[model samples]
Target chain A: MNMMTGVSPWERLIRPDRVHGSLYTDPDIFEAELKNIWYRTWVYVGHESEVPNANDYVVKSIGPQSVIMTRDEQGKVNLLLNRCSHRGNQVCSFERGSARSFTCPFHSWTFANDGRLVGYAFPDGYEGQDKAQLALGRVTRVESYRGFVFGSFAADGPTLREHLGGAAETIDRLVRTSPEGEVEITAGFLKHRVKANWKFILENECDGYHPAFVHTSIFGVADSMIGKLYGGASTALTRDYGNGHTEIDLRPEFRKRDAPMSWFGTSEERLPDYTARMKAAYGDTAAREIMIDGTPHVMIFPNLFIAEIQMFVIQPLGVDDSVQHVTALQFKGAPDLNRRLRQQTMGSVGPAGFLLADDSEMYERCHRGVLARNPEWIFLGRGEKRQRQDELGFTVGHVTDEVPSRGIWTHYRNLMEPI
Target chain B: MLSRESSATLMSAITAFLYREARLQDEHQYEAWEKLWTDDGVYWVPANGADIDPERQMSIIYDNRSRIALRVRQLMTGKHFTQTPQSNLRRLISNIELMDEQPDDGDIAVASNSLIFESSLRDDTLWAARNEYRLRYVDGELRMASKKVILVNNDKAIYTLSFLV
Candidate 1:
């Protein structure tokens, strides 16, 4: 392997068809990721529904940076760094809440929900210190599309829309499945930790080849029920939607099979009621199409992933540990539909879910496997030398192909390389 | 309130029921464990806090009798990958007492604190929880109408909780 003379260690780690094992195990490489990918890219924060009211706020993260996503007095969403200007203690410690102002427990320096310095306890202690200048520090930039908010540490780069690129349709299609065209986060979230690199989860999210083998116990028991509806594992449409995003859609045959893919229940029990509800909201044709649409597992690059009715954020805690916070998105007007979605969400990905538990073990096993000294390179050449561009300009491939993994590594290498 | 002798007898009966339940799971007697539940039984492990409605909020594990049958079936099939190296577990149950009763049903609500030791592969995880059992003493049989586990570490991220807790 010839190393490019001027390339740094991180840049040299990535290859076209395979990546070095150190990329997943080295703590030094984790630091490089923070600088190259986390700080440089636009990271998703929270959804608009989370902060619908004027004072509502939720603490989020952009890489290692803690940020507060709040709706201000004038009804505009603000992404403010959680650090207190005076001595830097986190002002908002709770996960999510609604309040007019944030007060630092360390010194009681207060800032409004919009990140403006409201007041301070010892005002006279600083005679010439400008209160306005002492306001809460915010991330470099914050932007949103359709209700999903995002932030970046850099002052300038590609806008969120441009960064989303071909993946915007994925997000749009997700929220559009709602009858009211809006989705709300369920009452709470389910969080679980996996001892592995975060990218492993990202890769597993789009890979269609692993599940039937990994979750064979769960799926095997329900083979008759699942096999009838899903048709077969090979029929899914797996493709890369550019900018490192990917989707593996397996429900395209729902209508053709007369099955409602959205429901985990059998088609006979769900279609009559579920289809009728859709028809009432969107009329017969659109309703039928929407019900039949395969609920794809869409991975928006670095972290955000949505599958079925659940949305989750993967927070990287350390080199070997990452936390996944999952929220079941509920329909605005459909109570029964929301309940079913909740059931499916718990059944699939929640902490004690039938599926996520399997994936977590696999990820830990992958991390542990790479601990071996030999086998320096992890082969990723499942389906190579074949790719296509969809109308939306996303790179497309076979459902079982490793094209998504290749796309991720390619974008990852480009992002990590120093300019 | 029952007499002191009556209360002690009731406590012993419930304690034996709880211990037998744990042993059934430890020995992989899932079918035997399944038979301990009532037809309308609910098995819930609430997240964030206790008494949370599974239909209204997210849960770590929430299943009615039928769903519980499905989960148990999967575990028994030797296919759940997380359980590939099946967990070795023992529950230390303590602080058994009767909880506040529901007015309508002839069910006794039993509460206890437990420290469950689960080890698989090279990892040993200590799982702590407040176990609340809604048992109906039907025809001299103790049936699990509901079991709610409020894990002390429920708010934190957990890995491979494949075995029943």
Candidate 2:
């Protein structure tokens, strides 16, 4: 009776210590995740800035389902299935626009911005049927916090506030830096396709161990900048912000370290005065928060990541491929010249940017290696023994440690396995 | 003392200079291309066809001479990973037309149709766009005051664009 006794793959995942490589590459597991995690969880869509006016809408994806996020005449935001009730055709084909109603291309079925059934091609087709119930299907819940929007698929789960937990403070800080207490997405976005597992981006961004090696060339250029400015000492500081978040703080010391003295002759003198002008405009506290020493890169677990001057949304296209959308953000009342400067700096990190291009190449190479035969697990044991607990109950490590990456993978495993 | 024939000849010279600039970019002769700009020249790739200002709408690429030089420096460095397996690109420019000529301000407005072909190890990409250039003559040489590119598929989902278009 017990002849077939053995550990199942599912059972193996339930174990705490390790995960098999199949979790990264298996088609079955990918399908399961699409159904259970992505479809069932509260996923981020677009920010409120995207649709600031009534009738404005943006197309987004939740799991495999394409949805439309729009504001109605009453100013309530609706997340409804993009498909038409008649023939499953996409209702809103454009990336974004302001429209009072969407008409299915295949059939002339129209739905209001509120997702209500407005009109049909033929009035005689459904003489006495329940036409009112044939409206576009809506998401289980659509909630927003600090202008960021999120939607859940399940009928029952924690609220958006509960889901964000301690991470809400980070978003608050981001908005508080803006003088108007709000920020809007700048026009145009940078889109790039990476040939790596979607989880890899989440892991790499927080993993401080790889940068000094993976980005040696970038550091080399930056080193020259530091040497010329600060007499050969680098000024970058990397810290682990517990619960899988890591922040890279670049300060004035970082700029001086290894920088060329000649590099600052023109721009440096102008920057401080400009910042001083901003300080006068927004007050000292706001200016200090906006400046933030150097640039601060923060990663919100699973998919959302924010750089000081930009916001990125990483969407999983498949287990082996992901699409990244990068958008520059602007404070409501900043000067034109300063906005241009921010855009220029943000450009250095786009698909065409020096740093991002190199990073994507490395990701592709890693994907290729993992796909090869006899691939071993990539270890994250660096600084594991030296981990020190912080006051917030998070373990901290040296700047060049794998603690952050391990933190992300640990959460990944926790989510993949049932409690 | 200039006649109509001389005016036509000058127009031809301006058109040739513009064509030469495109050739330099296609050949990756960035140093020579950089010389084709005025001191305050601007390169703009708007995200939308109707965009009038880079200050408001998002642009795919916007660079002044200094930022453009920085981009070149970054590309030439050893750390530019995205280009490890460097991409090779070839662009075709055609349908050149003179939209306006303002000799007083040393400026001319021109329009052209272009097609960009780029190849990498992963895939080959084709970008077709309409272009407009506002050139200002500096010391008797045509230099760009502004250059704008409007792509056909700017709003669709796209693969990595690791090179200039």
Candidate 3:
């Protein structure tokens, strides 16, 4: 807490077992996080399927900055800052649409969907101003892995693949669920606003510890097997895949029951055509394994959450406010399954979800509780002594442990303190 | 089309039904509210836009008859923490109009505009929506065959909308 000392705040505040409460409430710390983490990392923009045709675009936010994901004439995805070069008015205002070019309403400066400044209203205003240089600002890098687009502001850093590390396989797992080996994010998102820090969502999404207590009501009313799935009785594991990524692996639990498609509460018999298609796509062995393994429950650092049946993007609005945009994951070739996915997504996520409503309340209460500042730290030491590294060198722990939280903090400290 | 006198009487009956339904929701009368629905009732609240395929697009709330029963059961459990203290709610219904065309099932189509005010956990939220309803008679009593709520801000980030819309 002493300012005279030369030690960085992260060094002083982030311990092995706990983190400072100010991480959730301090405005200065939040600002620092924006600079060190969000602005510098490969933040997910949107999936390629969102804009399938040329000139299609969707507006999204990376940290606090607005950006547009567009598909241009060549069917290539482009990420450009929404700011117009003329006077900084946001060029595209609509959430999603198709337009070959964006014209700034203030001065009528137009730019192509691929970030080219094409025209302006008046000719006498400027003679030698370089139109090429005046194009809409773009991220330093934009990369895609399995159609998931990510943009970064920092020009010099680890490549998106390097940043994804072991988490790339998690994304692959999500895409692999499709019979055609591709996923479509065409279903519109459900944005859930919460009165809490963004980190709470990052941690809670893959926490694996709060379900039995925080969601007992839902489990009780629905007779959900989630309690047994993550209640120290199942064989599920929580993993920290380094680089701020984490996962709650339920494959082991599903495999133990030998119930294929049980993760979705359905069986192969219920979806005969889907079953046939899966086998035809990947053969019997791989398809059976894929069905048993199911979709992933993973947090891909700084922003993206590939939850089992859906995808969530956590955008931080302020120190104590955030919005989670959620969408149901749809497969490329499975119509029957896609419908079920939509229904299940309605049942479990979003602002009015049966399960997430309670979670949002808890987040608000946690933010309010942390604001008290009576307790200087939030404990995260569960299973720290017993967590082990799997064959992939990723840290693994019990389903009821704080392995994911500790993982997030460890990588967070590394980034905030850069060395 | 019905005669003017019959239309007036039907309008009065429909108005009464809507008011009673609104009161039951505001009072948290879960049992009574559940009873207002026919055996095959459908409740839908579409997201992003009102004209969408619920089976293809994500919805805020889409419940078939069985799911409706499950939803009411969940609300009544008293353990659904989101509604633990329950929201203090009041809604005003206006601009009720009988739509043209009676369906083959003897259901009357009605449309109305509403504004709901909910005060909970020291936070206040105002919700505005246009509602469409299909009403039919079952056992000599009026019942809801289907209800669709289209919120004005369906495309924006929504806070906890745990209560019935």
Q: Estimate each model's TM-score.
A: 0.94, 0.84, 0.98
| Tens digit of per-residue lDDT, candidate 3, span B1-165 | 799999999999999999999999888899899999999999999889899888788888989988887788878988778888899999999999998766777799999999999988728999999999999988888899999999999998889888888
User: Which DockQ values do the candidates obtain, in the order shown?
Assistant: 0.75, 0.41, 0.76
Work out the iRMS of candidate 2. 2.4
Docking class of 2: acceptable
Question: Stretches of candidate 2 above 4 Å error?
Answer: A1-26, A213-296, A333-342, B1-19, B50-52, B100-104, B136-142
Query: What is each predicted model's overall lDDT from 0 to 1?
Result: 0.80, 0.67, 0.90
Candidates, ranked, DockQ: 3, 1, 2
Q: Under CAPRI classification, how is model 3 graded?
A: medium
Every model's TM-score on chain B? 0.93, 0.85, 0.97
The better candidate by TM-score, 2 or 3, is: 3
TM-score of 2: 0.84
Clashing pairs in 3: none
User: Of the candidates shown, which would achieve the greatest lDDT relative to the real structure?
Assistant: 3
Error of 1 at A196 (Å): 1.1
**At residue B48, what lDDT does model 2 achieve?**
43
Candidate 2, residues B1-165, lDDT tens digits: the string is 347798687678767986788777666676787788888878776654546476755566677777676666665674566655567878888888777454556478777888988787656879888888887768887887778877776665555665656
Model 3 residue runs over 4 Å out of place are: A1-3
